[model samples]
Target chain A: MSQPSHSSVLPQTELTRHRRLREQGSFRRADLDAILDAGFVCHLGVIVEGRPLVVPTVYGRDERVLYVHGSVASRSMAGGTPVCVTVTQVDGLVLARSVFEHGVNYRSAVIHGTVRKVTDPDEKLEGLRRLTEHATPGQWSYARQPNRKELAATTLLALSLEEASVKIRTGAPDDGDGPDADLGVWAGTLPLTATWGAPEPDPLLPPDIPVPAHIARREGTRHG
Target chain B: MSQPSHSSVLPQTELTRHRRLREQGSFRRADLDAILDAGFVCHLGVIVEGRPLVVPTVYGRDERVLYVHGSVASRSMAGGTPVCVTVTQVDGLVLARSVFEHGVNYRSAVIHGTVRKVTDPDEKLEGLRRLTEHATPGQWSYARQPNRKELAATTLLALSLEEASVKIRTGAPDDGDGPDADLGVWAGTLPLTATWGAPEPDPLLPPDIPVPAHIARREGTRHG
Candidate 1:
């Protein structure tokens, strides 16, 4: 598969700089896109009434803009608020000979930006299409498009991906050459994999209707 | 399995109350413990210099206290700061006949509290043990424990689980009886499941060494 287009490197602001694990951090914009594309759900962090609130929401990305949608009355959907959108995929558990070295193998991206509401009618529809297609491919074209009333009820916020941080940790544990390696304990990585199981048809659907090809093909396929 | 001891229901504080989708919210303390116990990774949300930052980390819980550990120098690990820790598990994709109704079936917990540093040596040791066992059961006793020097390098914070918000969305899409049902489009849930694969041994390990029974038995087992 062709890689997503990311022409420039991610700009590291004072907030995006890695303070702890500098080696695991990356400035490559491609890494950010890969991390974002590998998952659909993200945790949105916003300050509400002077306290931080982290909410789980589904998101989509088109080039440099990441789109998140919610109800119009949702507090986190308020436009122009500074938000932190984080997407993480846990790949495995790194079993080490020492408890101190045990860690998770994962990839994560943190995007820090002020969210802008999509007020334009055309952009709003297109943003919604991206959001739907991001979660389930081919559904945007196969399903019924939104009407004016549905469009007005939803709130879509766009966040720039320019200021983002990507960190990835993989491979075996770091204690292979340490003192714990001599302890005769088993040490390796127990990989974790997620896959799509058989699609369960809606109980209320007519028995004559069959599952769509787009949805059927995803069965047994790997997910982030 | 016996349920964890929870004395009372979670207090519905001003912050924990669900402003939107109130029907999906729950104040039951048992629900909070179940959500926390099912996952090991969480997104830590904190304000650093007035900007919201979300970091992914591992956590453990002991009755009313949830412990999270990180490097002492990590900026987001600062003690005594008001923080939000969120744990989410995506069960499936809720595919609807209408693009407007597309949603994800998930269970998530948002914890809001001021984190206190575990300064006492005995408590610190116990906290670390809980964290280790939480992530990898049976490994705590199999592997070498952290030394005093290692403990000094780590920073552990305890957050009370008294104030938390639990929201769960499950089953099929809500548009089964709506107008979109006449469109002859597929509508159902594509279940997602994570499982543990075979353990990969370190390349430099002795050939005679075998995978431990605890880790070996977990292969092919389902994960949250």
Candidate 2:
């Protein structure tokens, strides 16, 4: 009945803490930052017109500010709204013999904060740069810069990353405690993995040009 | 000044749809269903006291009802509050020489609806079944059913899937029209994938038992 506290330690947070699988839930700051930095797109959760809205968008980050962009009239970018943004990456499947025990090996970050619309010209320019470069490390310098009209047409919101938590699940299933153990189920982790593949050349590419070494060598590597 | 409508044309449900990269957005009801059916854990987006909350949760589904369970005190399942539930699977990565053209191969489902607290005994039991079966295909039959006390302590919300949309991106990079095309920049999709690994037996399991065939056969196959 009292005012709802948005603090990270709200009573509800205590409930979500790893109950059966304690190691999977983390309160560490670095863990949350790492998971968020490795991903570019996030599901932006907000309330519009008393209804919840979860819109996916590209995100850019500075040390403390997380920037998200959309069209000027986009519902997600409505000024002064409180929003929660989440980034998640699934690393593998934690397969168990008993279906009840199956789980996933994943890393996820959830940030809760109030979003403020950016209006200053310099801050807007810098925000777009961060967004572009966040997606591709060297992209801001390589591409054409946004013009005055382009900047005006875009909408950007900056939210502080001070209130957030990281929840991660790694390793195998937890079916060891029951009588079902003797059920003769072959149970072990069949690790699921994802890695970058070779970059293909565009078909219309001119014959003489060659691939850049940095981009070419990045193939077959882990992305985040 | 009036409240902006969040609903869009059949395909443009999410904000990403209006971007220049329209091809990256998709709308198919079946795709949404399949992605949700395949996944167990979901990032639940909710609003509490005008602020947004994205909490990772385990969900189950019947034909129209998507049941979400939480502790009775969870802010996410507050009675009558609106919520958005999203389930996504990133299948592959799209790597283009030009960073602007880079993208990902993914299947994602977004359900936008109001929450109806499940109070009926029949629906509640059925919801629990769907939830357990969703995690493990045959799990409901194998495990002890939830007792009345457990049901009373648990909070379940049934949300309609009627206002949902599926957005999918697949295949190669979209760098065919840019100047980078002539630069011979490597432009192809680095296929991303997820599959089941060998299952690890519970440490306490007796030495004689073997794994079940239904789960055993899923080894190395893609799972939600």
Candidate 3:
């Protein structure tokens, strides 16, 4: 077997061991990276002044760390604090005949680490570029870079993905072994999906700017 | 004008305020309810043993409080615990010409409150019904309720929506007024939407089991 890369981006947590519903949890490093790359937003959980905070923030990732940005004054990102970031995509609703067996099929990752403030000018610029491209591919090269003043007002933090785990659930609910099997009730999953809709151009466009192929082709495609 | 009901949930701390882009912050009570009603899954943020934990859990709502449940063995539903619940829906992407101005147009509601264990037998039954309907509308009344043994192994918590805030952002990006506009870069919102697709019946479902109107009509509808 090929050895896994010992990168900080890889999940290396003890609790990450697949337990209850063992088949649902995976240890593939590629799985975590793929999920993070396909998604742009995450809920960053942190204790701010001793209060638990789970704020949704835009994020990007390099090979080693996940970067999240906010306003310089954001209480959630200020002071180079420690935080736990979780990115989740609900794949489907596991509907069982019995309420006790009802569950959801999902893909989720939880990262635990300190979000050190990215103060170096070069890293900050690169961080912003990663964030922009993460949201809309090729948009970074298309748009003007932020000036010094804008950069100064922004706060970016890089959190290692080392202490993380990926938990996934799929297929139907496990209602077979229980008495629920004979309940005469309907049981299965309603596959929940997120897809890209038709691209609506800016109303004020000179009417000459054609939609980029990358953006246009994404229309109606399933995301995550 | 008739005064709106103060039944609106209120924001408690500065951290909960719409600080970065104050204009997007919505204080209207209806906004809170609408966001909550539009979502069935919420990320519950709580501290366990001084370490923060963020768990995505399904929730049901009534006139005054939200109910969450899980296996009685779930560490997430410990009673008398303080937790913050957040429900977010990403409606669109604000893809401004300038990367600094790009953002996600989203509607999110955050509730900060303590979770109380429900002991009353009747309320537990009602809570289970609400949760069932929350996941699969019309199925609660159609399916068999949980038996006594199942109830003994389930945990339920009630969290008041008394202290909460709704934050929303919509429309195009704020790149129209900057020097970035002179770069002649395309700028506008790339709307992202989530909708329900055609319902696929359970393969094991009897071929004669006609899809109920409530479930069937949800085909191609927007998810709440």
Most lDDT-accurate candidate: 1
Q: Model 3 segments beyond 4 Å from truth?
A: A1-4, A7-21, A71-80, B1-6, B9-15, B71-79, B202-206
The sequence of per-residue lDDT tens digits that candidate 3 reaches over residues A13-52 is 5444444566766777777887788688888777766667
Query: Which 10 consecutive residues of model 3 chain B have the lowest summed lDDT?
Result: B1-10
**Model 1 C-alpha lDDT per residue in residues A1-224, reported as the tens digit of each score:** 22466556777788788877787899988788898988999998888777778889999989879998763124555677889999999999999888888889999999999988898889999999999889888889998888999898888889998899889998998999977788898888999998999998888777777888989998999999
- Residue pairs that clash (backbone atoms under 3 angstroms), model 3: B38-B224
As for candidate 1, its clashing pairs are none
Q: Largest TM-score belongs to which candidate?
A: 1
Candidates in order have lDDT scores of: 0.85, 0.66, 0.73
Model 3 TM: 0.91
TM per candidate comes to 0.95, 0.77, 0.91
lDDT per residue (tens digit) for residues B58-96 in model 3: 888876788887521146545666677888888767767
What interface RMSD does every candidate have? 1.3, 3.9, 2.4
Candidate ranking (DockQ, best to worst) = 1, 3, 2
lDDT of 1 by residue, B37-59 (tens): 88899998888777778889999
Give candidate 1's error at residue B192 in angstroms.
Answer: 0.7
> Best DockQ goes to which candidate?
1
Better of 1 and 3 by TM-score: 1
Question: Per-residue alpha-carbon lDDT of model 2 for A165-197, expressed as tens digits?
Answer: 667887656765566556655555545555555
Better candidate by lDDT, 1 or 2: 1
What are the candidates' C-alpha RMSDs? Answer: 2.3, 7.1, 3.1
Candidate 2 residue B127 Cα shift, in angstroms, is: 2.7
Candidate 3 chain A: 10-residue stretch with minimal lDDT: A1-10
